[model samples]
Target: MRVKGEIDAYEVMAVNPYKALIVPRMVSGFLITPILTLIGTFTGILGGYIITVMVQGSNAWGFMGNLFNWLDMTDILGGIIKAAFFGILVILISCYYGFHVRGGAAGVGQATNDAVVASVVSIMVMNYFLTTAFFGFNI
Candidate 1:
């Protein structure tokens, strides 16, 4: 929309573009990331159960037993925390790049690349610290 002039049009019409466009996206990111993480975690566990019990012929009870023994609320909460932060980081960084975009289509391409790279780097850095904070120094 910024590239296509819609954002400017909105601004000209007395709408705050940031509030109109960015806030909803940031809010959605903040809310949706944890939900998606929970869904993915559940799906992964289910898939593991299927593969272990059905394909590998493992005892279903034993598999479930080990799952409960190894996984806990803390692990799930840590994952959700990390995912929520990562989502916010990605959205904020992308919005910042997008808001500052210039030079037309070429600018959009460069900004997009920069946003992705920055987001990945930010996520990796945040993941390390978040893990350390949650699980402590294990080395």
Candidate 2:
């Protein structure tokens, strides 16, 4: 919707419509991805701790020892990197479709659907490549 608004408003005035539509999302994604990744990572760890220690009656000390012993910096860094890339992917794909929306409300709806599907597919494909590049057969 933000991209659509920018495109619609600047369609006649902007010298470069693509830049007008894409820049804002790019900037926002770059700014937001790392913060979100940190929050998500901590939330995931907390959820795991709650489920394993509280719900499953596991020894908290043993769980923490095993988890910390098995998990390395590479694992955490790789997840953060993947999240950042996914954020950029979603922003770019969404802006691409939304900025080009036509027809009316129906087009906007179609564009939104396309954007979500494209983002998910792109994230999965990119995840495979990123995993290969980052971890090879170890993952």
Q: What is the lDDT of residue 111 in candidate 1?
A: 98
Task: Give me the runs in candidate 2 sitting further than 4 Å from their true place.
Answer: 1-11, 14-16, 137-139
Model 2 residue 96 lDDT score: 83
Cα misplacement distance, residue 4 of candidate 2 (Å): 8.4
lDDT of 2 at 59: 99
Clash count of each predicted structure = 0, 0
How far out, in Å, is residue 94 in model 2? 0.5
- lDDT tens digits, residues 77-107, model 2? 8887887888888899988887677877888
> In candidate 1, what residue range of length 10 has the lowest lDDT sum?
130-139
**TM-score, structure 2 vs. true:** 0.85
lDDT of 1 by residue, 27-129 (tens): 9999999999999999999999999899999999999998899989999999998899988889999999999898889999999999999998999999999
**Best TM-score among the predictions, by candidate number:** 1
- Model 1 lDDT, residue 68, Cα: 93
Q: After superposition, how far is residue 91 of candidate 2 from its true place, in Å?
A: 0.7
